[model samples]
Each structure stands twice: as C-alpha cells, then as structure tokens.
Target: MLLLLPTLIGLVVAASIPPSIPHETLEVIPDGWKLHSTAEDSQTIALQISILHHHTDYLDIAHDVSNPESANYGNYLGAEELEASLPEYQRSAAEVVSWLNNHAISKTTLDGDWLHFETTVGQAKELLGADFMYYQHGSDDPVLRTRKYDIPIHLRDAIDFIYPTTHFMRPKWPAKMHLLPRQHIPTGPVTCATSICPKNLTAKYNITHVPADSNSGSQLGIGGFLEQYPDHKVVQQFLKDYGLRHHDKPYKYKVTLINGGKDPNIPAKSGAEALLDVEYGMAIADSLPVTYFSTGGRPARTPSQPGNKVVPRNESGNEPWIAFLQHILKMKSPPQVLSLSYTDDELDVPLPYARKVCSLCAQLAARGVSVIVASGDGGSAGTTTKDCKGPNGKLRFIPTFPASCPWVTTVGATNDYGVAHYSSGGFSNYFARPKWQDKAVSGYRTLLNGSHMAWYNKTGRAYPDVALAGSGYLTAGGGATYQQKGTSASTPVFAAMVALLNDKRLRAGKPVLGFLNPLLYKNEGMFRDVTEGDTDGCEVGSEVEVGFGASKGWDAASGLGEPDFAKLLKVLT
Candidate 1:
C-alpha cells in the first residue's frame, strides 16, 4: 500500500530559527557526548553522539499502530510476514554478540547486552566465518528448505534487543480537516471534503464513481466490505489484525476473525490496505508540524481517495481536500510536514497524476513543508509493471509509483542493521535522486532459515533517504498477535521521528523544517553511518554484483542509520 493525496496552502512569515539550544539544552549533553562500549574480550569501541536537541516535555511520539480496541495501538501494521523458514533453534541474541566481537562487518562495535547476531552457516559463515545467521525476505521463503545457508545454529547463538519504535503519543490526534465518520469508518477525525467544485490544479481533472457507491464512504453498503472480508488473509493478517490499536479508534476497525472458509479456495470481496498506511503515516503526520495529504490510496475509485477523501474535480479543478489545504495555507501559518503514502506503482510514473503529485509536493517543500514519500515496496519502483507478470500471473517486476517521483522527500526501507534488502529501497527507472537524497529527511531486512543480508557497504544502490527497522519479529493484528514485515512498517517509524523533531523546532520558533535536504547534507556526523550487508532483489550470488551498501559519507542501501532525532534537533535548531 502507498500514500497518495493532493493539496496546497498559505501562511504567515516563516518563524525565526530558535536561539542557541536553550541554556538547558546546551547544559545537558554538553556539545558532543562521547560514549563507548566494550566487547566481551575487553576491546573498547567509541561512539560519538552529539546531543543536538533533547525534549521530553512535548515528546509527540506519533507513529502508527492498532485498532480502536487495542491499548496504545498507533499505526504499525503488527502482523509480520514470518521467515517461513525461520531457524527454529533459538539462541540468546547476546551469544551472537560474542562471535561478532571476534569478527565484525560494521564499524559499530557489538555488545551482547544490547543485541547481536552470530551467523552459523552459508554466506554469513563464508563471509564472517561461522557462528552468525543471515535473515532472508518473505518472497525468498522457498530457498530456505535447501542447505543454502546454515542459519539455525547462528540464530540460536544470537541474543537480540529490539525496542518498539512507535507508541500512541496520547489522545490528541492531529489533522487539517476533521471528519464525521460516515458509515463504516469510526467517528472521530474528519475531512471537510464536500462534493463542492474543484478550485486549483485539480480543477482540470475529472473522474467518475461506481453508481452503487455514489457515496462510497457515506453509506454502509460500500463499507460492508470491511465486515464481509475479515477472513481475507491480507486484511485479517495485515490490516485489521495488525499493529497497536488505540481505544478511541477501535470502531474504525472491527477485529472479527474470518476463516478461509471450509473450502481453502473460497475468495472474498474487494478491499485494500490503504488504511494501514493511513494509520501509520497519520502518526508521522501528526508528529510533525506539517500538514499531511494523500491522493487517498491507489487510483481511488475514480473521485474518492484511498482514505475516502472526496475529490470534486469539477469544482475549481481541486477537490475539497485541496481547497482545505489552500484555506489552511491562507491562515496565520501553514503546516511544515506533509506526507503522502499512496502510490500507483502499477501505473506509469509520468502519468498526469504522478506529475501533479510530485509537482505539488515539490511546491510544498519549496515553501518549507518537508514532504515525505515512501520510496516504494514493489522492488522495481514502477520501472516494470503492466505487461511484466510473474509465474503467479501477478505483476512481476512491478514498480511502486510516486516514490519514483523525485520531488518529494522519498524514503526506502532497511533492516535493523541498516541493509537495503527486503522489497524496500531501490532506484526508480522513472525518477532520479532528488537533492533531498543528499540531505536530511527520507527514510530493509532479514531471513536465512529463510535468513539473510540487508545493506552491506555499497553492495547495492537501493536507498532510503535514511533507514529504520522493517524486518521480522512480532506484532498484533486482525484478532490475534502475529508477525509481518515490509517497507510498510518502516515509513511510520520515520514519520514519528519527524513529528518529534517538528515539535522541538516549533517550540523553539524555528522556520518549520523546509526542504530538509540542504540542512541534512550540511551535517554528516549527526548520524551513525551504516556500512554492511547487500540487498538481494538485484542479485547476490553473482560475484559480478557486489559492492552495494552503506559506507562513510553517503552510500545507498541505508541512507544513514536510524536518526538520533534529538541530536538532529540540536543541529537544525
């Protein structure tokens, strides 16, 4: 699922940059705080973390998760696609650290107390030499059955620590236009998207709606799909069942469990995963001071958006959403963070909408709103879709759209180690790296018992303007707890961080992070550089395709390791 929406706005003069990190700021982790960790064998490693900015007051922790029922479920689709061949044998993630102490791939020293992995066989064994395990991707599930890699012993030998990246910040949800739930959608947030006439660039566009769904969102008939298809694996396992659901938004989703039916082949109804993205991305949107927008998801059934925001193309060439944006911009101030998580990856990247979408985002960024877009999930990023179908008859080299649109702050996915494997990061046949790629803002995975490599020193070029964790482990969704993985999980986590930073900047009275590219590019050490592992969609076994990974300065794969958001605030503030 991708995020897509439209808009514009006007506002007061950009706020002034805040004063030199308030007295309290400079006083805490004075200037550069040097920290070090030691390996079991007694080797000391240095880690430089500049205490850029720290704020615990309004730590707007907005990321995604949960249904209206679950506790603190924001928008992380909880269900993870398990490494179907995960190494059953378990080992303390700490043991894996001991092995890395002897043989390490990255500059970051390993500490068993934190988290670590030890590869026991295959490529990792061959590369790092026995005792480590490699994690592979979901689609690569079939390869594990073979002795392709000795993954179990290494998995058992490792002890790992993973902190939940997102949590409900609080009950305060943010949005430009509030919405009155129509039928299926719960009543809470609102979108003033009336079927009024278009007013902006959208004024030139036109679309139609299914007659049965004249009010696709206002009526229950159109929303019945939610109830009827709870059994559908994609929905049950990923959307309704996944992530941390808050108590307020529970009705937004009904966790009724479904069956594949007595017959294993029974098919269900029409549906999509845009909401999962909305919830996740929404958290990010809320976190930031910027206004979030999307084209609703996919090519929203004609005029309705994925989030069901209505589009009145006939009206001023813009829909209510766009108009609302303009109205907000006309106010005393406009939002600084704008996010669109929808994409038409199956559609052409240069389509009229793609151009419009990217152009709009570019317009916002120019005005100071840092636009964030998901690089994409479909491996090819829309370079190969349409006629390109796989053995399963599904689009084979299908590309994710919009992310290919260079104007927005595009982000790709990465694993815990900052590797660009999974279906996340990659170059777009349709777009080029934007200036942002060189700057701040932007944003893979494992397996080998069905385990494997993510980002390794320039092993591949698929990026993530930055990186965050998007691999396996655990989550809760549908009606039960399960596991899942994908770039889908990474986007929101990044959004939340953006939100936290935005809050800090706003409180300090800074020009809301406009075009973050320049600032991010100006600073380097603020981030912990990622420098290992290789993304496999492009090919790995072939020695000819090596040297792709993260490294000193900027390399693809993992743009920059997970951000030290607080430190980043100090630099920017």
Candidate 2:
C-alpha cells in the first residue's frame, strides 16, 4: 500500500485505505507571520497551483549548455521545444484539472505549468482541508493564508505546490537614492571619482564596443514590479541632458505589461528603481533595444468609504517574480539579457516556493537568457539589522533568496575604492553549494577556517558572484537628478555590459551568454580582485561587529571581483 504512493514536493507519504482520505501536508507557513483571525468565508481568493513535471532533465541540460567547456555549450532550446520535452505535461494537467473540477473549481486559466483559479475563502478551505486565517506582519495589511495545507494523497503526483498559501515574502526594491538640486549636465568626460555615469562605467571597465542596432537580435530587459513604471520621456531627457548617443539611433525602449502591470507616462509617478534601471541601462548599452517588464503583484485597494483615503488591502497575489518569469518564459524570443533588482529574505520565503522560482530561472537559462539578480542591499542580515532576530529567537544571520537560488548570477556592490559596506553577501540557508562554484568558494571557506560557524550555513550556496561600482550614482528619475546607491545600481550596470557582450557575440554568429556562473568561475582572471572593506550588520546579542570580511579570493564581500570588460570580451568572444 505504501509503495503505491509516489514522492511529492520532496515528501514521502503512504496512501490510506479507501474508507479514509489520506491527507498529505504540502507547505507550511513561514515564520514571523502573526495569525490575526479567521478569514471571511465569503471573501474571494485567487491561487496558483504548480503542477509537477514528469521529466526534469532540463535542469541538468541547462547546466550543460551553459558550461563553456561542454560540447553542447550554447545549444539552447525554444519555449515549445522545452515544454514538449516534459512528457507528462498534458497528462498531469488533465489530472489536476479533473481534481479541481471535481471540487467545483470549474473556472481556471491554465498557463504552461501553472493553473490559476479564483474561489471563495470557504470553498478554498473545504477544498484543500486548510484553515484559512488572516496573518499580518507588523503594520502591513493582514493577508489571508493558512498555517499549512494538505491535499488528498491520490492527487499528490499531479501537483507540485500551491503558492501564496504558505509563502509570506513580499519583494523589496533595495535602491537608496536622494534628490539633488537640479544641476547642469556635463558634456566632457564626467569625473568618475565624484559619481558613476555612462562615461565612468565605459572607461573604467574598458567597455569600448558599440551595441549593434536594435534589429540585430540583441536586447536587454529590466524587471519592473509593484507598479514601478519606467517613464520613457524621462529616459529620453536623460539621454539628451547627458549628451549620450544611441549608436546614431533614436532613444527608445519598449514595455511589456504582465498581470495588469501599469506603464504611466507621467514622470512624477515613476518608480526610482525602474527609472534608474532604464536610464543607466540605455545609457550604457547605447543603441541596444531595452524592454521594461512591468509585472503586477499587489492590486490597488478600493476605499472602504467613498471619501476616505486608500487603505491597504488584506489580499495579495502571487509573487512578482513568478508572474514576471512566467511571462518571459512564454515568449518565443525573450530578451538575451535580463536584470532584476528585487529580492526577499531567504527565510521569509518558503522552501518550495523558492525552489519553484529557481526552476523557472533554470528554464530561462535553457532558453539562452541571462538571469541576473541583485545580491541584496543589506550586508549579511538584509536591508537593515534593527531589532534583527531569527524567528526561532536565535542569533543567526539571514541570507537572501533568488540570490541564493544557485541557478541565477547574483551580483553585489562595490564603491570607488573597494567593497561597499552595505553590499549584501552571504551563504544560502536553503540551497546547497553548487559544483561550479566549489573551487571558488573553497578559497574563501579556507580563509575563514571554521569561524562564524553559528552565523550561517557552511555548506550552503554563497552569492555575489561578482561585484561592481554601485555607490554614488547620478541617476535621473521623477523629473529630477538624484544620487543613488545599492546593488540595484550594480545589477543593471553589469547587465548592460553583458548585453553589449551579447551584441558582439550575436554579430560573430554565436549565442548569447546564459548562466554566467560556470563561465565566470572558470575564468577568474577576467576580474580585478578586491581585498578591501567588509560587510555590515549581523551584530547579534553581545556579538558586536559581526560580519564577513573581504579576502584575497571570492569572499562574500566581493565575489571574484569587479568585471574587466576587455578581459571578459577577449576570453568569451
């Protein structure tokens, strides 16, 4: 009877006799969420159900093609080719749909591997045997979720995991910026020591190659979330004010909206993160077509009273990462290079949800897309360490997710001199160390020699694969110029450089660089090693001034080192 049941979501379970329905727990709510009260039975709720794939060989296949040393290097797959490889996609969807239909969930929209449906709170609770309750975090609006959810043992094989059930992570954009008095834009070479701009990045990294025309099949993508619309008019003004040229082409960029994402043309309503990303990315990768992916996450709340101010809503949708990646993966020819500046604490995200996001990244890698992410803004602990303590009341350092996912290339921050103190870097608490980084991480591991054993996971995946200038950036946003700092600046800077390299590769009849970790680890000499500065925070209990320090090799502070564009292009192309 036990052998008849299959393994599901990394859990082993046994089927019960026909008289009883064997309920298997799927995912449990993460820590730091306070249960307020039971949700209203009549309240409507939306859920996304992840279906299990019959074959997952694409994970390894993604690695093989991404590795420069492999014979299948750059041999990528398309959206249809990759989906067809999953043998049981249709069968699994059929089973899951039938199960949902049996529960009276007839209205569902199936998109690839995800099945989306809306149901009443009462029906959701009765359908999945879950206790739906309102959980709140600090002063944030309370969200309706369950402590844990279970499914009938028979349907375990058809489902991977249900999202927004046990996951409580809300993505945070980590760029810190301040508005400055309007000043004259310099026409000559901008001083690199004072601020980071197009001239500074191009000259410092030896980035001399011109990006081909937009029709050359080379494009860069920036992720816009939480209504972060990139104002095109602002970017156009930035190009003109800075005296920047777009390879003799007009300054333009495209936007793709997902899940009702907004794209307001008003500069005052623009998000600083989105503006900085587009402004600098276009400036650096001049002439390359840029696509801003505005993904919707939280919906605007309706006023409880007609004349009252807008109050926060208690309901939330899927994580923006899920919606953004799902949209990109479905495209026939997605952008060759993508930069995302949003992140969440690893512990705040459930293990299954994190893994699901990682798998989506892997699929993008298989399709020959560079998935670049910010390591985070807070060093070790994340954003700020004020009253920082693990949910278990333990003095442990918190790691960042997606950055810790191992599948994507995570970049940290550096300054004019060395590693930025706030550049987030650390080992993952969820994923294990990957083989590609074994040699690189060993050098830093030996430097520690069993120190900070109680702080973070020793055998976990480490991040900030590489670091670049992130501080003191003169960014244009919201009809004003500002000085911004954070890994948010570093992420797009690095991504633009990669997009330029992709342009070179595309001209030479080669595929775009995808999954850069393996290639970067293999060629450590392409970066300038930085052995200065240390990460901030993680001061727990009486352990004052606790954090990882920069070392000779790839310590968390600045992984490998800052990019040397000349060396990278010389070796890669």
Candidate 3:
C-alpha cells in the first residue's frame, strides 16, 4: 500500500515591488490579422499559470530513481515529497498570490506549480501587461490572444509561463485508415490469421505469457482525448474475437472520467480511436487490469455558428493533457505504464508549454510511471502543411511532441516487422538531445553524413525509442470490426509489453522499469533491430520531399527496433 502525504501549509508574504518591465514577447500575431475593437473585455477567461521549479533537483531525482546503478534506484518519491523538494515554487507562489490579492483578484487556486484563476480580458491584459485581440485561423472563429506580454521582473522568478495566453496547442487524433484493396482480414481466429494479431505478435516477440496473480497489482492506463469514449461492449467483442476472453466471463476494467469525460454507448458516435486503444491493450495483456482515462475538454476545434467558424468545445479548464496530468499527479499512486496515442506537431505548441508538459512527464517518471507515446503517423515531416514550412519558407522535416520529449519513450509504426511508410520520425526543433541517447543519435548523424541534415535540428532530440507492428490489425468499433493502422496501434502494443515486464519484475520481487529510456539505451541488444524500409511523406509539389530511411543501428525511421520480449525479460531479471 502506498502512503499518502499530508499537505503542507504555504506561507503568504506581502512585498512592495517595482512596476512591471518590458518582458519577452512570446508570440507574434500572424500577419493580416486585424483586432476586433468591439470584442468583449468582460469575457471570462480561465488562465493556468505554470510556475518554475528547481530543474536540477527534479532531474537528479528522476535519474536516481530510474537508473539501476544508483543506490537510490527504485526509491520513487511521493507527490508530497516531490512537491517539498522543489521549494522554489512555494516562495514563488506566495509572491504571485500576494500580487494577485493586491489586484483585487483574491480567488485563485494553486495545484502544484499551476495557479488557476478566472479573470476578464481587461483584467488579464492589465495583469500581464499586454493587449488582447482576436485572430482568425482559416475559416475558424476568431481566437482571442495577445501578440506580446510582460511579466514583472520580481515575479519572473516565480512564474515560467501562462497557458491560453499566447500558446495554441491542437490535439491530434490517432492515424487509422481502412486497408487497401489487396489487404483483407483472414477468415480464421484472429490469433492464427496472417494479419497482425495480439496472439501472433506476442508469440513472435516472445511476450506470450504473463503471471496471472500479478494482475492484481499491475494496471495499464490508456489516455483518450478529443471526446473519444471507449465503450465496454466493443472491448468485450474485441477480446472474444482475439481469443483473449473466457467464454462466460463479462468484460471488466476501470473507467476514469476526468473533466466530463464520457463513454458514449451509441455505435455511430462511439470513437474508433478509443475502441482501438482499449481493445489492443486489454487483448495484448489479458491478465493485467486496464484503466481507460476518458479525458474531457476540446483538444481541437469544432465547426460552429454562422459561416462555418471553428471554436473550442470546452474552454472552462486547462487543456486536456494538462488536466489529465494534474489529475494523475494528485492520486496516491498512478499506473506504472501509460499509453497516449494523441499528439501534435512540436512547432504548433509554444516552447514554454512544450517544456512545461515535458517537465510534467519528468515528474511522472520520478514517481515510477513509464509514459509511452506514439511517434505520430505523419512520416518524417509533421502532419500539418503550414507547420512543416521552415523559417526560410522551405518545407522542412518536423517532429511531434511529446514524442520528441526526452523523458517519454516514443513508439513508431512498422508493417510486418519493417518500417511503415507513414511512421513519423525526426529531430525536434525546440528540445536538445538528452545525454542518454547521444552516442546512438551521433552514430545516426554520422550515417547521414550531412545528407538532408539542413532540414532538421542536429542537436534536437531524436525518435522513436522503439517500433512494433502497426498495420493490418482487426479492431472492433461502432458495433463492427474493421482494419486499422498507424503508430497509434504500435503504442498500446508496446505499452502492454512493458506492463507485462513490470508484472514479471514485481512477481520476482523487483521494481518496475520506470522511465524506460535509461534501461532501453543500456540494453539495446535486447531488441530486434529493424534495418529495412523508410518513412515517406511531407511532399511539397515537385521541388521538395521529406523522409528518413531505416539503418543498421538506431535510426529515425525505427528506433532501436521492435522489442524482443523474452530477451528483454531475461536481461532485466
């Protein structure tokens, strides 16, 4: 049983500070956008102020807890302990709250490093020292944002950034498409079918067995965004179809609804993405308990009103991912392994927001959770046309986040044990490469030998860390079975494998593999290195094309390659 930490009382201090100074301009309003003078200043807007933390302290804790060589390995921190270790936030929070109180905005809530408060546009502009305006994107509704903002010099140390201020992070859906004419599901049991199935894939990868008793303590979490709901009925059918369910047994799993998350019963509206995630995870790790987290809030825009304008469906709370992270952090114990299939181009999200989300992943790692994210299905360049365009107006290879985040393990897609053409891979423009992957990435760079090198950031973090079968899988959704494909399929498959590994470790009286990169990089030989195929996409007419090819070692197309589960288990044990 995990022990919960008592909340510590924060001390509020009042200080006389100088007037605000001209701070850095975070984002510039796009060209040809005119401000709406009639836009309501009284419109209520909820803001999430992200506070800075002691970077070294958290990084040290993450390393010490994850590295097997360290004496502190497996000694994970509780939520309270993590909070206490970063004392910078406490002082910073008090100062910011005091400042807020003085501005007649005394009603504010603080959760870890996030300070939440509701303020009008007029008051927000006054507090942040900026002008708020409406900017139109395509035919979408005018989004309210500030071109630039200033924070008081004294309070700068306390706050890193604010969300919904200048950042626009759109959530991406799983990459699933119907099989081509040549592709078809086999007539026999899914396990014996030629197409990739849980049973066949597991057997081939040497992950055929998991201890039954270990299921009681092991849990796997699947994150759902954009209102995708995982129905229980569809999951049961999927399990039965794959021979994973007992004849008379009913489907069983936990459902956590965060911020109005829903599990729609209707087949037409029941999300195929959610169904694929839950079914694959439960089918792969049959014994382990699965928790489907249906997180709420509109991660993307929806068509609304007159003239087909696009607008956010939920504007009441933080972004879906942020809210989901906060909810998990507040728990006494979060799932050891979490699989997220949603992602967006790294360039679409502002630097500060990306860093904040990545920092939260680091925090999750310190507490023993292994975050597995899809590397995306946009090939070498990201899915967006505008986002892929470089500063020089040339099409460049773009990466996705939080796959590009160094803390989380990213899984790419493969078809029949080879790299899939649409599997997204590349280096990040915002984040630098972490020390753990330096040698492998450096080797890849040497292999490239300056070929297409100018299209990406050489020092940026490279992905993905692993690959798995991502195409020609049968999935049940909307009351019917269909073939699906994408790195979305690979992520859950890899996560379930990790969950099984954790179960084995626990049964053997060992700690779960927390923050997989350290162990993964150290034991690269444990995996089946994929050396063929390439990711192809991001075409800009006849002049430019973007993609990366598989190589002998770790390459952008397929990381260290598919996991050889039996080998991985033997090595870890």
Candidate 4:
C-alpha cells in the first residue's frame, strides 16, 4: 500500500508539469568559436537582470502630465509617488528576488526595476538554459558570450531584458572640431563676427538680455561620458578669451561624478567634446545654474576601446548608456533641462535594448525634465565608417538613438541659420510616427513624392525637432582654441534655449516644458522657419545626392527651424 501511494504521487506531479516553449534568444555565439574549458566551470560571471512591470498606467499618467491641454499637466510625480504607484513593479522585483534566493543565489541587490548579482558560469548556464563560449570579431579581443538563452515559462512575464547580454551599444560624443588658423581669430569682437562667438550668436537669436529675476530656481545639466573631463580653467579661459565673463569673474559650474566618473584636473586628459559642451551651455544660458554630470562606467567593447585601459575597466560590468540613464532616473532632483551630445547608429543597437532606453527617456520626460540629444553628423547615410555598412555592402541610411526616441527633443545642425549639409536627419526604423508630428511629416513625405522612399522607413518617427548653428564655433580645450562643428554644438545651444525657457515658465508659475514635441508642434510661430539648403551625403556616385532639404514648413533637415526667444517667451508664458 505504501509503494502504490508513492507511485500515485509521482504520477500526479509529472502530470502537472507543462511543456517548455522557446523564449527570446538573448545572444548568439558567433560561428568558429572555441570553448574555454577552464572558464566554463571556474569563472564567476555577473548578470544585471532587468525586471518587467506594467508601465501602461504610469505612461498614461505621464502623458497626461506632459500634455499642456490636460488637467494634470503640471502635476508631475515625485520619486516616492512613482514607486508607490507601480505596485506591479514592486511585485515583479520581489518575485525576481525570491526566485534568485530559491536558487541559492544570495548576492543580489534591487534598485527600482533592476536586479543585479554575481554567479558562476556553470550556474548561469544552467539557470539561463544557454551555452557559453568565447568568440573574437576580426582582430579584436575575445569576448565570452552565448548564442542563445532561455528562461522558464513562468518567469518570462516578470523579466523585460538583461544587459551585457545580447545587445552591444556604443554611444559617441558628436563634437568634431578643427583647429582654426591664427589669422582667422579676430583681434577684437566684431558685430556679426565670422568666428560665430556665443555672444554674437545669442544676440542674433534674440537671447541677448535675460531678465534679472529669471533663472532663479532653474537648473541645466550636460552628460559627460567615456572618461572625458571638463576642466574649470579651460571654461574660464574660454569665457575670458571671448570677453563673455561675468564682471571679470570666471564662469563656474558644479561637476557631479557618478559611478566612478572622474574629472581629472590634468589638461592633457581633458577632451574637446567636454570643453565645447560646457562652454556653449554655460555661455548661452549665462544666467542659469549649470551642472556637468561626469558619468563613468566600463568602456563598451563593441566599437573597440581606445588602446590602453587606464581607468578601472568593468567595475560595474554594466553598459555605460544604461548605467548613465538609470542613474539620472533615480535622482530625486534632476535638472529640469539635460543635454546629451552622445549618439550611436540605430541599427547597431538591438531592438529590445533600444526600446528600453527610449522608455527610460520617457520616464525622465514625464518627471518634467526636458532631455535634448544631438541627432547625428552622418547625414542620411549614417556614420561615415565601415561599421555602418550593411551586409549587401550598400551604404545604408542609419538613424541615431536617443535622437530617434520620440519622447525627447532631437536637435539637428545648421550653418548660418541654414541646414548644414552633414546634419543627420531621417525617419526612424524602430519607432513609429507619433500623433504630434503627423501633419508635418505627412507634408514632407508628399514633397518627397517617393524620391529615395525605398531607402527609408516612411512610417517611422522623423527628426530633428529643431536646428541651430553647428559650424565653425570656437571652443577651448587642452589650452588651445579650435573650431568645432557637428550636431553636438547645435544640441547644447538648443538645450540652453530650453533651459532659459524653463526658467521663464517656472518664474511665471507655470510648468516646465516637459516632452517638448506636443508644444513644439503646436506652436510653430515660436521658431524661424529655415527654407534654404539641403542635407546631402552618402556618396553613391561622384555627385552627392540631396537626402533631405529645409522647407517653408517642418522638414527633416531643419525641422521647425531656429528658436525665436521673444516669440517663444510670449507663447510659453
């Protein structure tokens, strides 16, 4: 009777089990890879698992808060309120922790929606149901990865994705500066100087005189990455050289380092990208308080490292972009306006990873933070490198990330208020067109009349939201002055403008311009429409074809055009 009862219990347990189904293939090990016998069992691996939760309600609430016409427009959620609202998020986090604990994985920590822990390669392989091996791309260093991964069916709903998993993203600093000849420098500042000084440009754009009471509580920030450090001395000299200092006082900004981020005072380690971003942002928005975020993390191995590894590599072993955004999201008092000059080609990033990043941007926007990103400098052809080439060897049109995200304002480049030829502009392949820009994009598509239509995704999100000067601006770095060009220059300029606008709104007892698309699209009169020049590159023949052009209305090359400060103030206030 005891043996029969045991057999009956075993049969019931076996009958309750469900068949396994195929889930997402997190990674695919490249062909011709050799396994590391020693690494398989002995090596310890770290995994940063991202849990999924129902964000639909939160997104809806955010959208309402962002929409100016809505009743809840200015009612943004605080960090505590946000956490409390997402019961599903809390539940998912607890479930993931419990599951890990049940598996005897004790080293785990939870932050918002991410669960981080370390485990052995053997345990990871068994846990994730995947094989791990070593593979090298070309002459690059070898990496340890798996071709595919599987999760238990029950846990799939709770997991969104994991990083350092399958996706590889390389965010680039978009500043490309050329050293100006000594003869080109003016002995004294001239009205409408050819060098395009920040003062002259600000005056031209009608942002010359900000009210004394403005910018009282408004704050602006710039994102720094890849060990790039902005020196205070460089910024001061730049302000002095251009004669834009405040009563002989050197311009100053607070540098906040995150995740081992460094701001070494050594001039040799300082970069032009950092200098230009700080100079333009501070110089333009002279009245506002500014913060420079020095975001540090391990260098991504996909685009290859810059030779030597001086900084601690893989300290967190997390992707820099994700880490940077996550850090910002958790901030209790993030800057109202944040400018980022970094970008990467859209296709280089995996779809799930890109979507997750974009969603994070949405979260930031919902909290009334206006995030600005440089579109790209690659024109319609994408980055001018071998990596952008498709498998067919044809030069493909690659859109850029963060810029391609519809939640944030994407800034393009122009020369002398005209669309710059190299200013990257196109529709996105990953994101669809949002309702705000439908009329404008539809008109632009009609103008194209199917010209180069086959090369791009027409139904995708189009950029940029606006354009600004991006050519031949003087920037100081390494104790020398250089002329910088690219959408990087344009981004900080626009970000400064938005920062000033936010200041005005805050002073007027109004909400900061959150998720600027709806407001920008609705208020066309606030900007000067650029109707000249064309963005042409990705040379197929001897002649460069025009990819997109500036038009009377919104066009991909120049979007709504440069900002008109007076008009913007009137509309916003």
Best by TM-score: 2
Please give the lDDT score at residue 37 for candidate 3: 36
Candidate 2 per-residue lDDT over residues 227-289, each given as its tens digit? 777787777877776535633556789998887677887978888899889988888888888
Candidate 2 off by > 4 Å: 1-32, 182-193, 243-248, 299-316, 384-388
lDDT against the true structure, per candidate, is 0.33, 0.79, 0.77, 0.75
lDDT of 4 by residue, 457-566 (tens): 89999999999889988876664568889999889888988888888778878878877888899998988998988886556556555578888889988998888887
Q: Roughly what TM-score does model 1 have, to 2 decimal places?
A: 0.41
State the weakest 10-residue window (summed lDDT) of model 3: 5-14
How would you encode candidate 1's per-residue C-alpha lDDT over 510-572 as one tens digit per residue? 434545544555566556677776543433234323323455555445655556654675675
Question: Which stretches of model 1 miss by more than 4 angstroms?
Answer: 1-334, 344-347, 351-353, 380-400, 426-463, 473-477, 538-548
lDDT of 3 by residue, 382-409 (tens): 7655235753455678788889999999
The runs of at least 3 residues in candidate 3 whose Cα sits more than 4 Å from the true structure, single-residue gaps closed, are 1-18, 22-38, 136-142, 179-194, 214-216, 245-248, 299-317, 391-395
* Candidate with the larger lDDT of 2 and 3: 2
Best by lDDT: 2
Tell me the lDDT of candidate 1.
0.33
